[model samples]
Target: MKLLMVGAGLSGAVIARRLAEAGHRATVIDARPHIAGNCHTERDPETGVLVHVYGPHIFHTDDAEVWDYVTRFETFRPYKNRVKTTARGEVFSLPINLHTINQFYRKTLRPDEARAFIAAQADTSITDPQSFEEQALRFVGPDLYEAFFKGYTEKQWGCHPSALPASILKRLPVRFNYDDNYFFHRFQGMPETGYTAMVARILDHPNIDVHLDTPYAPGMADRYGHVFWSGPLDGYFGYDLGRLGYRTLDFERFTETGDWQGCAVMNYGDPEVPYTRITEHKHFAPWEDHAGTVCYREFSRACGPDDIPYYPIRLVEEKALLSDYAARAAGEEGVTFVGRLGTYRYLDMDVTIREALDTARAFLSGGVERGVAGVPG
Candidate 1:
């Protein structure tokens, strides 16, 4: 069977590799000149530091299968995402850990003491937290919420925390102990050569063909046995219902000798700060040393039609549009949706690969045109 894999990111690469290995031909196409989608990374020519081109992507997941799959393509260096934030001209550890709590209150509190203190500060009035503001007040209280979450959330999503859903704050890590690691995943690492090289390795099979700078047309689906689209869901349908809302980022680049911030990621918690975060590219690759450093000040805003969409907003309005698109997709033949953009959800790299692997397995195992929507079971 001949398959058409759209996007050429982790999803398309993984699926195409699996199907090609199973004695089928796969053609991978990406509208961009390169692969890896938002997770794209490359080395800085001047500083020799491995730069995350799109943004900082720290590979962290509990799924051992996904970790093993990626390691096969590229060697990974041990990396932990320890984020810092700046608020009121003061620097603090992120995720609101015990250290942050103690520092904010200017008190040396143990884990138990810190837990009880936060509980006392929490708003008992908000028994059932409905929005991001309510959830923050219910748990962390107003001081921490104001210092850590409120301004950042406003800048990130371009809306007040009260308007956002509670689930948005639910995913945020708040540790009782001093552990400041941003993510709680067992497996965390950065690809040695970069993400693009890893995806290139995945699509290097003999039976796979790659076409960069190629746009996907609905009519192209007729040329292949099946089309696995990892592109934007609304984009595949030409946004007839409406353009699904998305948050895109603007990066301001600067170079400095030695280290810029002496940290990989530094969040600007103050709404007064125009940018959300600044990432030093060299810090992401600690194993490599350089005389100069490269950094990007990231600013998030509403995605315009011409901008590169980073994450789907999935607000109430967008969800309705997604449902409409999904209904239309289900009725279509010889086409399947996969990955974050295709599914219109915020998916990590591990989940993306796992679903791609599962999708490829189902298709190769005589499940032709069945269960190929790429939603993990």
Candidate 2:
């Protein structure tokens, strides 16, 4: 079978490789001039430091298979993501651990006392919270929510905390212990050779051909035995049901001597600051030492047609619009929508690869169809 894969990112590369290994001819195409999608990374010409083109993507997952799968392409250096935040002219560790609780309240409370103190701060009045604001208040109280989440959440989603869903904040954990590890995943690390190199390895199979600077044309659907689309779900249907919402990013790169923020990522929780976080690229790959550092102050805004869409704003209105696109996509004769953009949902690299592997398996077993709509699972 000859397969056409649109978008040579993690999802497209993974599925293409899997199909090739299954003795199928797979050709991958990406609109961008490179692979790895948003996770694209390259060595800085000035400093020789690896830079994450879109944003910092620390590969962290609990799935052993995903971990091993990535390690196959590139060597990973041991790294743990420790984030910091600035609020009211003071700095604190992220994930709201014991250190943060003690410093914020100016109390020397132990583990048990800290837990009880946070519990006391929680608003018991709202038993069943609905919005992001209500959920944060009920869980961590007004002061913590105001300092840490309220402004940041508002800036990120471009809506009041009350308008956003509660599930967004629920994923973050608050602990009485001093564990400031950003992710709770069992396996966490950065690719030693950079993400682009890893993705290049994924597309290195003899049966796979990658076309950069190429956009998928609707006419190409007639040229392939099967089509796997990883572009925007709405774009595939020509956005007939109204444009889906997404929050894109603008990166302001700056050069610095020595360490910039002394951390990998620094969150500006204050509403006064427009950008969300600043990532120091060198800190991401700690094994290699570089004298000067490069950093990107990331600004989040409403995604326009020209900007690269980072996060999908799957609000109620967007969901309804996506449903219309999904219905139309179901009628596409030989296209399978895979990955983040294709499904119109935010997905990490591991989940994208896993889904691609599953999609390949389904195709081989004759269980997968072209023009399937929505998420696979």
Candidate 3:
């Protein structure tokens, strides 16, 4: 069978490779000149520092199979994401750990003492929380919420925290212990060379043909037995039902001699600051040494027609429109929606690859319908 995989990122590459290995020819196409999509990484010519072209992506997951699969293509160096934040004219550790709590309040409380203190600070009166603001106040109280989350969330989503869903804030953790690791996954690391190099290896199969800078067109699926669309879900239907809301990022790049910032990610928790976070590219690849450093100051805003969509803003209105699109996608034939954009949700790289593998397996086992793999029901 001849298969078509749209958008040659992790989703398309992993699925295409699996199908190609199963004696089926696969053609992968990406609109961008690069193959890895947002995960693309390249080195700065002057400083020789590897820069994450889009933003910093740390591969962290507890899925052993996914970890093993990626390691087959490229060597992964041990990396832990220890995020930092600047708030109220002070630097603090992320995830609201014990150190952060003590530092912010200027008290040397133990783990148990800190937990009780935070519990006391929480607003127990609000038994049921509906919005992001209420959720934070119920858990961490106003002081931590205002200093760390309020400004950053507003800047990232372009809305007041009170307008957002509580589920959005539920993902973040408030740690009572001193552990400052950003993620709680068992396995966390980065590709030794770069994500682009790793994806290139994944697409290097005999039965797979890769074409870059090629946008998907109407009737392109006519020639193939099946199509896996990883592009935007609304885009496949020409956005006839109106466009879905998304938050896009604007990165301001700068280069400096010597180390600019000691950390990889330094988030600004002050609403007054224009940018949300600053990432030092060289710190991403600690194994390699470079005298000069490259950094990106990231700003988030609503995605326009020509902008590259990053996060799907699935507020109440967007969710209703997404349901309409998902229903339309279910009725389509010989096409499966299989990625973050296609499914209209935020996805990590590990989850994307895992779902891609599963989608390929389902297709090889005779499930080629639109709603088989990742389509929302």
lDDT of each model, Cα atoms only? 0.89, 0.89, 0.92
**For residues 1-377, could you state the per-residue lDDT of candidate 3 as single tens digits?**
99999999999999999999999999999999999989999989989998889999999999999999999999999999999999999999998999999999999999999999999999999899999999999999999999999999999999999999998988889898999999999999999999999999999999999999999988899999999999999999998999999999999999999999899999999999999999998998899989899999999999999999999988989988888898888888889998889888889999999999888888888865675233355
TM-score winner among the candidates? 3
lDDT of 1 by residue, 258-295 (tens): 98798999999999999999999898888998999999
lDDT of 2 at 147: 98
- TM-scores for every predicted model: 0.97, 0.97, 0.98
Candidate 3 residue spans exceeding 4 A from truth? 372-376
Q: Is candidate 1 or candidate 3 better by TM-score?
A: 3
lDDT (Cα, 0-100) at 249 in candidate 3? 98
The runs of at least 3 residues in candidate 1 whose Cα sits more than 4 Å from the true structure, single-residue gaps closed, are 368-377
Candidate 3: give the clashing pairs: none
